[model samples]
Target chain A: MSDLSVLYDAPGPKAKRNATIGSVVVGLALLAVLYVVYARLDEKGQWSWDLWGPLLDPSNEVFELVWQNLGTGLRNTLTGALVAITLSLLLGVVFGVARVMLGRWARIPVVGLIEILRGLPVIVMMFMAYQLLPALGVNYEPLPGPDAFWYMVVGLTLYNLAVFAEILRSGVNSLPKGQREAGLVIGLTPLQTMVMIQLPQAFRTMLPAIISQMVVVLKDTSLIMFLGQYPELLYQAKIIYQDLGNTLQTLVVVGIIFIAINFALSQLAVWVEKRMSRRSAGKSIDPIMATTAAPVKV
Target chain B: MNVIIDNFDLFFQGFLKTLGIGLICMVGSLILGTIIAAFRVSPVAPLRAVGTLYVNLIRNCPLTVVLFLIAFGLPTIGINQSYYFFGCSALIIYTASFVCEALRSGINAIPAGQAEAARAIGLGFTQNLRHVILPQAFRTAIPPTGSVIIAMFKNSAVLGVFGVSGDLLGNAIILTGSRGFDPVPVYLGIGFFFLMITIPAGLVLGYLERKAVILR
Candidate 1:
């Protein structure tokens, strides 16, 4: 019984004991490095303490600048994400269904759209949008604070819709034939069966992948910084760093904040995916947070 | 048609520039990425840590900032490189993170028994890895790294402003945006040019994935 326990764990009791000691030694080493870093900051005492210590100081101008920008940035980020999420899902439905139901005359265009858009680098898409839209006479310039906002949203949607089409197509394809046949046996139209039976179950299987793709979308909004037009949270951090000549510290804060946002989004994705997968598999609702970076099927 | 016919030389020139920059960035990144990937997967813990921190910092932070810092900011402190090297350096570091991760995933998929068997032959770590492990790992790594390469090719566009002069989209911007021609067709044309590269890469990757079916 004891041997069984030892076999299952990577670092069994003996290895664990050794690793523990090793971890302590490494931890102390890390502390020594931090101490050196702090001591170096003391040498450059003017910038270091002011910059690094701003997180605690509620009244620091840097914190206030971040706080103000953060609020507006969050609102703008959410707005961009909202528009993207909405537009992508709509296009996903259109193209995804086309992939399933339409012939080549219809499907080729959709397929081309997916290929071009998905092939696009996210940053280039934004850059292209910024340049392309103004030249296209899509210049509804009557609206407010830089039409690049709308362009960014549209670009994100274009890329996402292309990828989401993959998720949707796969989901719909994975539905067993019997469900469609059963609907036909009940004298329902093929379209009705698709709407009633197939799409629902397809969505259930695809929910996780779709949600994960939203993280792809969320992280992408950071790409808007390329335009140098949008004062996003990322841009805001860049500003402070550029202003204060404290690039590393500002970036640390920026990275931590981005990670927190991505983490939260990932948690939500995991939650939805778990429910959908569990229900599809007809298992007891385990609600496991499957963070396994498992191999995607080729 | 006349628009292109008149400037066919310039267009071809731009196309060649785009391809050249893409190829240069691709080769540079793959070499740098492979070195970092090998370092990351090395047995030496400190080497792995060093490589991982490099990847994390480069990957999570924006590439644009790195390019700007290197391109514009460096001159202020008296470090000077041509914009070409700066662009290539940024692209190499940034895309290397993704390439390293993709390769690492492929390397990880290699069964533990392979390593054990290599050890069983009394081979040292480097020799065992070289002789027995890496060839198999390369096979596994091919599909994902292929896609990463394709993605990296697409991403090389980001380096356009850092001195890929006569490149497709950047040149289009400099040309049309200055001349007041509609930039839409220029970008659309550029996007199509990219598709010519990316689509074939995707197909090759798909074919390789099918061939390398560990699980099918």
Candidate 2:
């Protein structure tokens, strides 16, 4: 008999019959659950066009306004995410390299900083930036974006930078010792070896991981809603639903947008991972460890 | 310092709530995640598809969106519960996706021969998984599952802002917003409490990771 999985052999005639029956039963159960959900929503008049028309109808004036607001909110969310991703990477590389290259005495404080940053929740950092910073006279006027934008960016950057740094550090550590020794043997200083040889390779190997972190940053920009006055997508969706009396529709739409964008980014990560593993073949590093090593504390 | 001392009761209560939520979600997600992991690895194609769909849809959407959907959307359909219940459900649902992936990976790491041997001995698929595979998989799965739970603890902080009061972040918000406490010490207190849990948990997880390494 042909083997399909270690867990099971290819089904014999009796087994195949049993499998088909199981499939039919499960399929019907799933369909029944969906029907129940649909019936409930229909009972509540949730299918009424008045609730969905503002989001779905192109000709409606409210539809135009809704789209425009959501568009602006999407733009702001992307702006914040883009800036945060950029800064997190730059800072991650700097601190990652420093942690590796610095003397033990110097590294201790850096370790402390990274641990604290990694430990705190992103929402806490966001609150500190949005509420605490202004109270302490840390003005945002010098920055180009709105105060809330900068706050969101800073909060995301602080948490993500620590995570990115840990990823890079682990990437560097996972490399063969020969690579580092050979650089030192060739008369390169440790810092030069790390900068010229090690860090670039770490970046290449860690690219998939870095991209995944970008998804986390993109998703986190939604938290700007709590900061007030920041018209990020979730916040704008709130405004839309509140104004239009379509809470369920607006959130579902926003959720779909988030799922679409983040799913694309996650797919990009998986694609990079496949390519990287192919290129390195036998020496492939585990990209999953790079992510799970330092938990993404969103 | 004065702000923290004055609001010690608030901080203490918040800490308990945060710990409570973390504990509840950890147990909930583990049980749910184990079931999903089984669905994923089952020989049934439809079951596998459902598992994959659930994991992907939940994992890609931000936890915040999940929270918003459950916290706001459920009430409209007459499934209204305490905000705390909604928050805990969202966290459990979101975190379970990651846990399922971790467990599936652990199962995949097992040698094919083991499962083949179980079936060669005339074991059914369920017995093969239960008696032969899963017991081994849990060991390999411990580290990643620990990381997921730790991340869940941090994520529980989000519930504080989503109308689930009495968590660490919620207390900080109250002190800063309505109580008019200085924002600096108030937030620092919150940060301190989070680190109190996360730092120690990280140490424990690290030790467990080393211990869990299969010698083979």
Candidate 3:
């Protein structure tokens, strides 16, 4: 009853009757649609144990093949995401700081770079790196994994760099002007203040967003499968389905894996966010007392 | 440039298909999202649960996985359709979660008193939502909704991943492979069309948001 105000009041006797009828109608309509979709799927033999049994059986040979391929694909996908995250986070921080702190001439170029990189589709950037770069004599033969890995990493880095820069810049910009002024008042240089005072707090403020971006990085790794043949989870799933002739079963397994990993990741981020907010709230006790020079009579 | 000129018809077809898919998905997701948002804010328990479960499931899953499921899995279910149709369906399904979340936030921004007042005036659930709540809520929702649409449009590039060759990305790939053209310009050409659609849409949406009437 207390939460009822959040949306609407509790229905009166007359209104309750109407609501019940309305909800029943809505429920029936939804159920009818679901039944139709389910019937169609069932007709296609999608529910057959023959198509799905091998995937479920622990002792089956097909499971062994799938498990091995899953390892390789998972490793490659992680490698791409890890390398891209490391490069992008570092470069993003640098670019973000420069955009805010650098002179007008320097800031303009950074702005232009961020804009162009952000505007282009990630796949197009990947294509450029994989297909266009080798043509331009920019070979990465020494790089680990296939050419596509480097291309995907570089592509992800370019796109994410722009995104992370914006995130960090806004995080920093949102801080109080007094924080910077206090640094200057204490005889610290602007650079010192930014590094020692501003950045630490900005990192804390930006951690949740950065973690969410990591989820994006993981998802973008799947896009690399489209550019060229790479041993990512999606590509492996494609191969398995074609070989086993159980397209639906293979894809369902792969989709479950992706959802599990990503869902866990996002949940962890939410947990950390809650914990951090609690810690920050505890630390910021007595804001007025901390800010005042002298105590006033109660 | 020569490749584009020679394959103008192919590019034009690709443009039309991309536009068609984009428009269809946008409308579909918006309508579905509004319904889901209503469910989330509804007083009934089952309706709220359904909305919550859907948004949680769809938002966490990758678009590629969803598309793959639709493209490959639908055939097994005897619902075989063109890749384009399945691709459009996937985009609609995935994008609707984001749109629902956006609209839910908009709904949440309205003061509790607004809803209470409407109920006091004897307005029913649907009437309150349509006449009082949504018009005000949409003013705050415009920015996030625009972003969801833009992201959805960018994501439609992946329709080619399903071998739907009637999109900008698929056409670019085919043009490069068949015509031996440089990929840079081909991609640039494709990117131009996307930016043309999205950037203008963003600017107009921003203007609309600024001009939107705030009821509360």
Candidate 4:
């Protein structure tokens, strides 16, 4: 038997009988629980088609009423995620390479910022960006729009910047020592070695993690709705619910949209991983294995 | 700082509520995660399918959406409760998938021989898991589990968005609005409280990880 199958014995006739009985019992229990839950929902009129009507028909007036708002919300969400992800990747590369070049003592400030930002909640940071920065007389305007949107972008960038730094640092360190040594032997400065030889390879090696963190940035845009009028998908859904009183239906649709986008991104990460391993003929270390050795920062 | 001291009761209550939600979700997610992990590795095909489906769906969805669903969806299904209840429920649901994945990784770390040895001694599946596999698996699982716990703690702050009162973030917002004080100092205090919770937990988990490595 393989590792996963070791505890699972090959079933003798009696063991097969027991296994069948156990399956039946478990199946019945599941059915019973589902039935109870369904009955409760039905009794509360939750199964009525009226609540789901607007969503089922694209031609409904309700859809028309909310369509513009939904578009705006979707646009803002994408903008926030894209901007933050791009900025963080840039920041991450710089700091990650710095952390590697500068020893522990020299990198104290960088390391401290990463640790603190990683520890702080993204929502709290957004709050600080939205209210505190303005109070402190900082321009607080990264983008020329609503303060909430910029706050979200800034907040998300900071947290993700730190996380990607650690990921990239580990990614760089995981590379063969000879890669750096070879660059130095060619008369390259440390910065040149990193810029020319190491950072590019580290990024390729860490693509799965970087992509997964992009998915995180996308999801975090939802938190901006908490800040007020920051019309992301979640905010749009909330607004629709406030207008239509179909809270469950609105949330379900919004959830489906999020799940679809995130699922697609996750699948892309996996596909890239498979393609990379195949191209390398399994020579490159499994990127997932490397990144997952640490607690996933997202 | 003056704002923090002057409204100490508000901050304390919020702190307690935040901790309460964190504790509740921690325990709830652990139990749910164990069940899901068990389902995932079960011999029954249907059970495994269910477990896989649950994780695939939940892990991809944002916690905000999940929280919104629970906060509003459950009311339609006749289980109306406070925003606090919905917040805790959402945290448990969202975090359980990560916890299950972590535990599954731990379970995978076990050598096949240990499971085989247990079965050779006539131990059944549950017995083998409890007596032979899980204890060893958990030693390796501690770090990821700690990360999930810390994540859940940070996520508890999202409860404020749904108008849940008495959470650290929520009260900070409330008090800032009510007292008409500069939000920077209030938020600074709030951030410190979160760092206090997360930093120690990180250190402890780091220690445990080093200790586990030594034992290995």
Candidate 5:
């Protein structure tokens, strides 16, 4: 059941020779592309020590300052993600349950809200919140951070709650009808059946997807830097690079950090999926990979 | 409301630009993504590794970082382009990873027996993929690819702040930041335009998904 063998026959002597040739050609091609990129950067004096020293050289005073700025930016990013993750999960469960369990009168509006939120871009929602919050007399000075921080949190939460709700709904929908029927026959109310049986099962089934969505939330926190005031990772990278004139190096560093965090989260999701599928004897539905899926992060 | 009415031309132009970017990137990503999918599924180990590395690296980094690398970092390396070009490139590159995944998943969904049957019929590797695997894969890939493209369109809104003028968000900024108009109406108008694109696209994709279901 090897994936490769499904596509073609296992190689004979001739096919093996051809595969070796193909591998060599592709390997050389990749190396050539890498070399060209390196050559171009080197030609532009991009390898200058002055540009790279602050980020790479620890003894320099600027190195410490740059790291501190990046550290603060990382903290701010995680804080915003943390708040949005918590709030969105809560809203997602409520709205997700409502969409499934509520009467038509209540569910339609919930459906409408989720659809509208899903349709609009997160940045637009953030800009709207940035403007609307102050107008609504929601003073920011008393809050823990700048006005843009709250704006970012609110906006991320709004969009993600819709996504999370849809994910949960899909999770529940994928379950066997027998689960709910059995609960009803056992003398449980619909709400009780949902809370006691379906909801917990959905949570377990959708945990991988929910975690991956958190990765999206973390990445989205960078968009708030566009608000021009929030000192998130990207914003702080901007400040450091502007001072050091090492835009490329600073961004590469920031990019690596983002990749590190997100890669860890994605691996966790894969691990959770594996464990859940094993525990359920391969019965879990992988909504994340399903076709016609919910609105996943861009 | 008055601001939206008065700046109708600007908004319209912005709307068109957003569509232009989305359409161009959608096509670009589809082509690139298909190529990457071929690489991933091909027998060559190096090609598969390259595809895996490219997908993982791009998918993990935020689109904003990708945009910054293209828009700002490229210039320092003497590869400057218009912000619009950079914006489109960033979107295409970022979106292609997800597109590749969607397509790869589609390819995987084809029953192993189908591929074996193709091989049994004396089809070569490329022939088996082109005639048998791909046709079925496209059917399954359509729904997820549509979702990815829709997400890409919404992502085009981020181009506004990156100095790509004449998109919906860019025009919204012109109204609020410079002309001193109300942000509420301006963003609302923009939101309406976005909804106009996404909702219809979603409905069509849903229809296609239903149609694509194999009776077997």
Candidate 6:
């Protein structure tokens, strides 16, 4: 059996420093928490530590209600992220390739579309989709919820598609000219040349960037709260935290949920990047590896 | 033309509200972004962690979460401030994350030695950051910041969704719902309104980018 010690081990100096600093940070954080409790109690006119007692009691109805809301919100949030991320990548790759390969005549229009849509905020786009499409008679009936969810998803698809296209374009542009010539010499059609040769290589370089951009789209889903229906996690948090009159307390759960989820997504991207780097690493060493020791260096 | 004249004052007021929120948040976020970026790039591990946590959380979290939490959640906590205060606060907070990330990107664009050189010349950290490192980072930061500013302008319209007293998009929604007018004109109007703010802002930012190049 292989020992996983090296994989699990921490960097020694960094860990030592982090441990000392982490303790102090937690200590200061506790003091701030105590202050918030005191301030909140004073606001309620009860002015006692007894209020925090209920928070520790897990079985309280209100806490249960909040948890139920959070659970549902997490489900919707995850589903929306999955849908949008998948669509965004597909659209991004298509647009990016189109942008790069467009003749001089068609390039400006595609590039312009990318800049304009990319410049618009995702929230505004969500509003347009939710509020605008129905008004314009573009209707899609989903399971009984005023079309806001679908609109939000489609809007996300549009905005992210634009940016992803630009990212793809940049990736394609960065490819050396030799690849294109080689593909053409092999008698491939222009479309085939791109589909088989250029696109895969370009996407390899674009993967990390695409991951970061997808995180942006995933986070942007929070704005769907404005469509007058559908509560993503943040909306659910707002509904509860507002009723409780303890923002710091409520946001503790909400913020941590966001942080935890986002951190996981980022780590996933990092994992992909690491795997990609390793694969690319071998490609990088190939020239030297194939050189036959440079004819004994003489 | 008739509708424009009929709702001239509402249109003008809404325009002002959008301008007010966008400009204030833009400035506020840029300032907050700088401080956060500084912390992010700091040598101290905990400080860096705090910075990382903040950027990562805000970046992955949606803008509306921060806004809704402030607009609805803050009032229940006894803050209950005016719409302007709440709207701007949410916007500033939301924008700051993007700002921090943008400025950090700009910082990353600068060579690592620029700060060390400034320090080598006997400048203090703050002084070195302000005088030497920042000027260069601002250049690298320009393209992203330009888009960020445009984003801020566009997002300002969402204040309507939060039920702000006076804002372009909310006002349009109100007009559409209550007045029973066609939604196209109003949305088209709002789109034009945003384009007015963003397009010029985009051009100016682009100009500044070129100007930075020439001056540098």
User: For this target, which candidate reaches the highest DockQ against the unseen true structure?
Assistant: 5
Ranking by lDDT: 5, 2, 4, 3, 6, 1
Q: Interface root mean square deviation of every model, in Å?
A: 7.0, 3.6, 9.2, 2.8, 2.5, 12.3
lDDT of prediction 3: 0.75
Give candidate 2's whole-model lDDT. Answer: 0.84
Superposed by TM-score, candidate 5 places the C-alpha of residue A295 at a distance from the truth, in angstroms, of: 4.3
Residue-wise lDDT of candidate 2 within A1-298, one digit each (tens)?
0132778877999989998898899999999988887888888888899999999999877899999999999998899899999999899989888888889899998889999998888888888777667777787653334677888888999999999998888778767788889999999999899888788777777888788778878988987777656789998898898899888889889888888998988888878888987653124544443477444321
Clashing pairs in 6: none
Sort by DockQ, top down from the best:
5, 2, 4, 3, 1, 6
Candidate 6 docking band: incorrect
What TM-score does the first chain of candidate 6 have? 0.73
TM-scores for every candidate against the unseen true structure: 0.77, 0.95, 0.87, 0.91, 0.95, 0.79
> How many steric clashes between backbone atoms does each model show?
0, 0, 0, 0, 0, 0
Per-candidate DockQ vs. reference: 0.21, 0.60, 0.36, 0.57, 0.64, 0.20
- DockQ of candidate 4 against the true complex: 0.57
Query: Candidate 4 lDDT, tens digit per residue, A168-272?
Result: 887677678888999999999999998888887777767777887788789889998777567788888788778877787777777787788888888888788
After TM-score superposition, the amount by which residue B163's alpha carbon in candidate 3 deviates from its true location, in angstroms, is 2.6
- The runs of at least 3 residues in candidate 1 whose Cα sits more than 4 Å from the true structure, single-residue gaps closed, are A1-47, A50-56, A127-137, A142-144, A174-189, A192-208, A238-248, A263-298, B39-43, B47-59, B65-79, B111-128, B131-133, B161-164, B210-216
How does each model score on lDDT?
0.66, 0.84, 0.75, 0.79, 0.86, 0.67
Candidate 5 lDDT over B84-199, as tens digits, reads 88999999999999899889878877889999999999999999999999999999788788888988999999999888988998888888888999877888898888898888
* Residue ranges of candidate 2 with Cα displaced over 4 Å: A1-4, A135-137, A140-145, A281-289, A294-298
Q: List the residue pairs that clash in candidate 4.
A: none
lDDT of 3 by residue, B1-216 (tens): 776787778777887887788899999999998988878888766687789888877776778888887777667656778887898899999988878877766676678788888878888777888988888877767766766776777788888756777788788888787877877777768777767766666667667766884755
Which candidate number has the best TM-score? 5
Cα lDDT tens digits, model 5, A89-108, are: 99999999999998979788
Q: Please, what are the lDDT tens digits per residue for candidate 1 over residues B24-122?
A: 877887888888887776544555676878765665445655565556544444457787778877777777776776667666666676676666666
lDDT of 2 at A188: 98
Two-way DockQ contest, 1 vs 2, winner: 2
